[model samples]
Target: MTTSSLLSGADGAVELRGPLASRLLEKSPAMKRLLVYLWEHRAEELNEYAIATEALDRRSDFDPRTDAAVRVQVARLRQKLKEFYDDEGTLDPWRLSIPLGSYQLQAEPVTKDGAPPDLAIQDNPPAAAAIPTIAPQPVVAKPPASRYLWFSAAGLAILAMGWLLGSRWERQVQMSTASSSAVVVSPFWANLLKGGRPTQIVFPNPVFFTWVDKNGDTLLVRDPAVNSYHDLERSPSLSGLEAQRGKPILAQDYTVASDTRAVFRLAQYLQPLGTKISPSSSTELSPESADSANLILLGTVGTLAPYQAYLDKLHFRIPEHKQYIEDATPSLKAPVHFETVRESPTRIVAPGIVALLPGHSSDSFVLVLAGYHTNALISYLTSVNGLADLQKARTSHGNPEFFDAVVLSEVNGTTPLRSWVAAFKPLAKETR
Candidate 1:
């Protein structure tokens, strides 16, 4: 007959405030308060103005007719409720919900297979369908009848609720669809792809051999050393060393083999983000170029110019760049050093650095993927199961935004071997 009678006899009104209410309160205090208030007065003629003032604690002059804040919050509350049921309360026998277009809280007893009871419009007439306007069954109010006031209030509230409920549902559906189609990436790649800037890949062309003046003989310097012979090709002091010493100038060309595999793999990995990596020559890319975009330094330290500058800034030292030597640590116990064993021609212990650092400029990130030599660097980026290994390393280090870790790449020149986290620096503070 009336709104009160309809609500009192409703099938699912009693258990509306039980388990679901408690969980809702835990996640969102505002939603909990709003849901409780609406449930308490579900039977009365509700107006948007009244709901804003009472449940939302807005100012007395707050215009629910114009301000859409209440509608927005209600939409969020519905989404939160959906998440709760989908996750935390998935198996619960009783499901609580606020029906579309109405604030009335309903508790429908789910069947053996989670089927909700049939809530046809006839059985639950109070919770109206999505509509522009709705006339809730009239209530016999105070005498000298405020008929216009009651009707207008009821109409305004129901219209606000009904139209917005349907619209919010659509928005939620769109959001879910968007998220499903969104980019998925490894955590380590996130910093490199930060701010959606163009990513630059610096392929390391290692200095295989260079012209050098050693004593009176100008020789081909294949060894990278601290007291290395002067690069006769580029050194001003050693400009005429080859001619003066009566020796042939060694070939100045030094380049590592192209890692076509890492390039393709990275492209596929970043395809979801709609990013394309630009092939930047190590010599072509200057400090200023590296500062403008997200940089992925490929291969060994040779590929990355000014990497020594970075090491200086971060207080790390790797002497004798040719072979893997013990790092000059800030402390002997510091978790930032390398142990090398020269087995034969190459260093037996090949350690690598997968360091993420802040970009030189805003919205920039510099990812350093380097090692003792070309082989080690290539292994880390491609053959070492890099993405998986690096992700696990990042996780082990508490997943900091900036990190530098020593990855011991146990590889015997392309033969499969294990990798380990030799050392970790979870919080590598950026020196800006």
Candidate 2:
């Protein structure tokens, strides 16, 4: 609230200005957004999703299930912040740092009552607030006046995000909706939000497939949910099949009815919270979206196939076509993977993974729900009174902030006869 503080870089905390802002201007657009966002919204809870939705122009459609864009960019922003302070900001009196996985950028005065004696908050600013046209005067390293300019620079950084970040895509994206459901205030939910704030629910975008016939021959085709069958153009297997029997591939809109039902079921529990449970998928999941809010992700190995990178990050992972959970790192001799015998690989007891990890920011979280086949997830959520069961499952361990679960979905023709939590293991906080 201090205003009228004469800006300076040395002997105490100073208002941000010319030098600080100039240095930030040299960083990437994402970095600039991170810095400015922290400066303005420092007092509020922040995470990757908030940065993506609010800072990165990701709208309501944004998803974080399959995308790690927010994680990558935030890591880069941290590096740049270090570079700024180590170089141009070395002598600056204030120490500013955005804690890893958090949006709170804290500012501390080098001395007690470091703000200038003249500084005071007022409804109106004095003429000195707009000091302009001062000639660039040469100063040796660590000059006292340098503090003043640096404070000005910090102010400029805040101004830049408010004006510049918004102008870039103000028309393309809308602010987060206010109508989402009320936030759930529970020990389990609190672990996800870490601050009793809203969280996002992300679904998976499965890759679709089709079989097409041209003349007397049938051809296998891969569809990318697009208007064209462009991927089949380079298929060596298809080319070989064509040589034996003439045929062509066609495009079709892939639809899985059961998968749709699973999504609807997921929404039943999540959307009730309204805006607190913003819905998105890997296809549309922006890096920042998952960072900002606690996330609930749903899919199977087939549907979640696109998120292998994220799958690798999970402590309990069920790889596509693999019948076991890949957690050998903890104990190679231990048989962690459980499989059920069946006629078809697609129809066997599918493996579902439910995991919770530190979200993009330390204050947020990501919850992953998936199975081997798409139906495995659908059956579990729709049949076992999912909404209630999920809550029970989460609290079973006394509201753990991080855990990896191995889930089994026993199916009787797309209906989960019963579901079980085969194994549970606590995972270390995400260091990577």
Candidate 3:
């Protein structure tokens, strides 16, 4: 039988004989779950966390410990498959194996004449006594030409069918691959504002925030409290704050659209006094002495109380930031106006900004936080954006659960950040 013919039929149970069948029987439950998931979602691209979480039965239950365990199981499963095929020898008619980094099942057929030794069994037994004999019978001969014609026709039909099916399968695979690449290569700003879970880090005192992206690229953003600004008077280099200015710090090649000049100015303003400004300062900062002088000075003009009041006044303008605060908005019972609640410990809300970066023709997002409760804010942000489950995974695992961890800053708060964080509680859990 030809390889194409092997794919025919709804059940296709016979086609799965040999190594594939043996592997299925021998695989562990976790390995089986992983395989089944890959088979079901073959048309869709999945990440490691998503695969592991699904296999574990609870997407929110992932941790480093669990992740390590799953990796070990998959390794063992791969080894077992290799040993099974090697022992069965080339006689096995089918190939069964999992490709690395991808949880996919690949199968192909071998010629029937190549059937494994274990599969060849005979029913007739040889006579114990040599005295038993039988007469030979005349054999009928078949035309070789007719047999060749039949085989050729079958081969042609299989080829035509394979071409049609294979073309469609190739298109599906291309589309899936393109979609996955787009998601993976998306810019940092895009992922931060609108993609995965959103994390807010509030700063009690100005501290430099730093974190690494998947590509090992470093991102540095100073809090409003940093007390120093970028000194535009100094020469620029590809390192430090100068390299970051103007150039879109691409995450996956996506750029932030917010005024690169403003970002440069912000970075400069955060630089401490006596710090030399970059030579590229002319490209980003105004040359006026007043502007240059004003650029480098940084100090806390007011406390959290006043800052919270200022934010409440502009609440309507900042939708993303306001949505987060409103969801976790604390209750107030008094003759106090919303602004009055700003300075009080109970009323002090952190100030945050969500800036959209433009790349090509689309917008990506970047968020900056100023005030107390950075961790709590990040937890809250992730929770509200349907990414709380990812946060849970990271908290349990001791590392981030997604592609990026833009920045994190420690700050004190009375309650667990999770307590104030709000999840997108669905009105109905099921559609039916």
Candidate 4:
């Protein structure tokens, strides 16, 4: 379809209007303006200089060589368009697109088989397939024109009704697949799942000191300082108690309540996206496993002790007290301390840290979700508005490849009311 035909709100065609009309593009004025400018001048042969000057309002002397503002905005707008098509705009008759290495917006219709009309058939498709493209049916030799004379009007009507029903069925399936793919491409999930690599949902197995009496009475003790049975020897309080209780045996059977819930949620979220999810305890993880898959560590500060080296360079930390998140370097925008605030007897505000760090292998990634409450942290990471807030936070920091942020969640008792990103810091690139 022509650009004007698509934009003119033609019958069964989707319209591309102002920013107010698009949920995904509304937050970005630059992207909205760029989209509208491209649509208005879809017929023109445009370049980066024209887009920079006409759409972005760049200075007349602006140089595209040294400056890359236009390119950056175009890249972001491209991603947003893909995300929009995969999500709320899934059923739109025509899909909007911008060709790579260029600034032009192209519209392609959704063919009956779901693949774009211009898409070429591939010998082999990727394992993480979204919607499979239907192969073209074999062409049969045409018979005499009089062969169609056998069909009656009632027969033709029946065939039309069947086609309508079949088309509706296919659209329903497309919507289902598109929604799942949308999550994989979303801001929060894209980092981990979009790579199409196996994701290892690593949960912590914190050490617990247990004393079993001769009478079959057992007492369990959890000291924050003790990570291994060897570490228990160094703790004076735990050693003194061990002396009276005979001997303390180490146990790694328990996981934090939040970690369990987070694991379940992660499994439910990723499984639908056709992501290969492997759930393992932190104790089972090694350098080799880290090198092969994406890692998502879910638990409290104690659970993060094994990976403390990753946090050494990060600005925020949950100290021994486990009460507040501390920022080593404070700025006017980022506070030194993100302490818990009591809004009322049952309501409180607490801080959580969501850090995306480089893994042992350059291709792999590690996502650390550290917080006291698992529900709020995972809920925030999964929700649309929550991820949108995170996207805004990441944008403010120029959209770093790897970064960490302090997210605040308002909770009433055990229930989380809302979550928002309070501070953000772009992580330094890992040195070889």
Candidate 5:
């Protein structure tokens, strides 16, 4: 049969015959004809020109000038046939093939049992058989400027709300800090005065002190004139100590004089006790002397039998007291390269006395006696360095609730430690 006639017949019966003819036709009419030509003249050899001419039909309109386009069409159609058979006709009873330089078609039996050849043709019919259907979907378009405007408005609203909330929070925080500051009494001087002491004592704005007693007990001596002292015998004991009526002695009698010369002398005595001396001139401590001095100071502070018992109760060691100075020394001295080490050693000479006398809430004042050089001690006490270290320690030790507020003041450089008591004289007059 002519190639055209065989292709027409195959097209009509493609669904019943197999996927070969249907797939070839789906690609292009020229390719379908080429396939048919190959099938019909399978025993005949053919060249490219003959295949192209047959693909374009036997008409003058099928010019030699268009033979290249026709060949390309045929090649594309063959590829489509290959893809169809690979995807859906892999198990078909008939196999199709095309050899180069030849136009022919051949069918090979793919199934066993020697079934009738026509059975394959009857199995697939062209019409009335379902083919995969793909429905075209409509494309969607969006409005431009209005969408962006809505997004911008939402972003601005979020930013404005955040700014307002942040401002309000900041204001509230500032107010809270100011209020807490008024009531925040520092613990630096808590050990300097007795907790229950009723003495009329004055303290400077800033002070540091600790209790010398091992029990951490503060002595509360009553002022005979105050009504609170009248019931001292009936009142609760002072830090658990009995209250005895006696004239309060001046602080100078019990401690060193609070003057520069006194401080120098005290610092001198303390030199063997780890007290760092900043002399007017450059001087270096021998390594052995430095070690010996530090050892003595640490041993004396750590083993102060009275305070040791109390500190032990709190799990605090005297080494901890000097930790800040020791840790900060390297950083502090890095810039100055000061060979003569400047140090401030602080020790509490007395426990603070807090008296609940018959007066208003504001009538109370705390006594503090912090021992340090007028120069080095002032800088250490006023700076946030020590306070920050204490805060970090509290956190690391898992004692988040611990808070200490200290008032620190410098001793007069001109007077002795004894004469320095005048500076605190004014605190006794504070109204309740």
Candidate 6:
């Protein structure tokens, strides 16, 4: 009955047939299947493509770049395992974990005291081979000197969650929790946070073209028109630079510092009201998750492309791959186009929009805070003056549950100095 024996087929099959696997099966049949698949194929190098097609039964054409289903499921499975061990499996002599940066299942022995034997923890597994990017054309072999870096959605999620758990924001959240009983929630947030649904705050991981420079340093270029792998392949600018830089690879690893801060600020305000808040990256957002929880999306036009269905319905929106707000309302009023401007070497002016709409599910809601400069958009949305302006505008409009408002922010570099509401319009509930 040694714990090491659990790694054997017979012992493993016994555990799988026991209550542990059954619990996972009860949680999600797909998760149980994934666990069994990993257990059976423990010796093989499990990549995203293989796991998707083989374990998860994804189509042969499944692309890991655009579709994060496999990664999401794996992450959920990992969480489920940790949950099992923390509770029901506390007395189990062995624990299974998927090593970070790899898809292999690992078994670590546990002591009688319910703790692992004293051993130096190993560093994260080495990075895997670059998963192929999604493009219209077939992937061609490239020189080893130049290669793409496919960012993992799970890794980015961990980074984002780590920030949320940082001491700075955690302290602020603690303070907010103390005074939460006396604070009154505003109508804007009240409408969204009603029904006690969990809130998922998604921050964008915008697309960037990365290539190694002549000096052996990696350089990142952001072209507004290119937001996806497909866009990177067809860009006219990339074609000219391909000779020297090879083909530029698309990655969504970088998050604007302002966006992360905004999420913290938002969580600090909402958590005090007994609302559960979760921080996630835009890449990690899925249709099912969006429908199940209240979502607060913060990002630029290119980063928010996945939500184009909702963005299209907004009367005030920055066009795809562009940095300006256009008024699409067809009325007697004049056309509205507010573009980003450079007032001086030290100052910048940008347009932002705050839109509230119904979610995919009837009970869920969506709050989109978008702009060319997210620093300004989020700053305005969370500010007292900015919220007062929004409240005043909504009050005049009879306080519709769904609405869109355009705001202008004066910024110095990445910091937003001040923002003002430019326009507001209430929409019917069925507008979605």
Backbone clash count for every predicted candidate, in the order shown = 0, 38, 29, 0, 48, 0
Query: On residues 1-432, what C-alpha lDDT tens digit does candidate 4 reach at each position?
Result: 233433453222234742225678655666766777776554333455667888899989877556878879989888988887777776766677886644556655677766554342222322112212222111111212321111222322222222232223333334434224433435467546677888888776756566667775545555655677888876666787788987877756445434554565456455566777766777778546567688888766666677777767678888863568999877786579888888877668888888888877656788888877665787677666678999888888898888988999876555555789988999977721
Better of 4 and 5 by TM-score: 4
Instruction: Kindly list the per-residue Cα lDDT of model 6 for residues 1-432, writing each as its tens digit.
Output: 222233353335544443344364465666777777776654333456678998899999987656878768888878877778778787777677774444656455575666743221112212211222223111111112223322333323333333333324444455445434444456667766778888888877766666765664555444555567776656556555676678776656546545665666567556546778887877788646567788888777767777777788889877765567889984566448888787876567778888988877777888888875665676566556678988889888898878998888876545455677778888778965
Candidate 2: segments with Cα more than 4 A from true spot: 1-200, 208-220, 223-255, 276-281, 286-293, 330-334, 343-348, 373-399
What's the lDDT for all of these models? 0.49, 0.47, 0.30, 0.63, 0.29, 0.64
lDDT of 1 by residue, 1-432 (tens): 333333353333444434334455465556666666655553232345566888888999986435877767777766676666677777766666754533434445565666554332123433222222224332111112221111222433333232233223333333223222333555555545647888886654323222334543223322222112233355333335445654444321223322322333344345555555565546557667667777777654434544556655443434533434244445566654466554544215566666667777877777766654333443354322555766677787687777666767544333213455566565455554
TM-score of each: 0.45, 0.44, 0.25, 0.56, 0.21, 0.57
Kindly give the stretch of ten consecutive residues in candidate 4 with the minimal lDDT sum.
134-143
Candidate 1 stretches with Cα past 4 Å from truth are 1-184, 206-241, 244-254, 258-265, 299-305, 325-337, 341-349, 373-397, 427-429
Whose TM-score is greatest here?
Answer: 6
lDDT of 3 by residue, 1-432 (tens): 322233232123343444334544343555544544444443233334455666646467675333555556656666766676677535665555654533444443444655431122112211111112222111101113211111122222222222232223333333334223322221222343342221211112222223345564444332222222342222222224444444323111111111112222222221222222331111122223222121211112211222332233221122311212222232354211111023333223332222111111122221333222332333333222224443553455353212212112111122211222111111111111
Runs of candidate 5 with Cα error greater than 4 angstroms are 1-16, 20-24, 58-66, 111-432
Model 6 residue pairs with clashes: none
Error of 2 at 286 (Å): 4.7
Candidate 4: stretches off by over 4 Å: 1-187
For all the candidates, what are their Cα RMSDs to the real structure? 29.6, 24.4, 27.8, 22.0, 43.3, 19.1
Model 3 — which ten-residue stretch has the worst lDDT? 250-259
* Worst lDDT 10-window in candidate 1: 139-148
Full ranking by TM-score: 6, 4, 1, 2, 3, 5
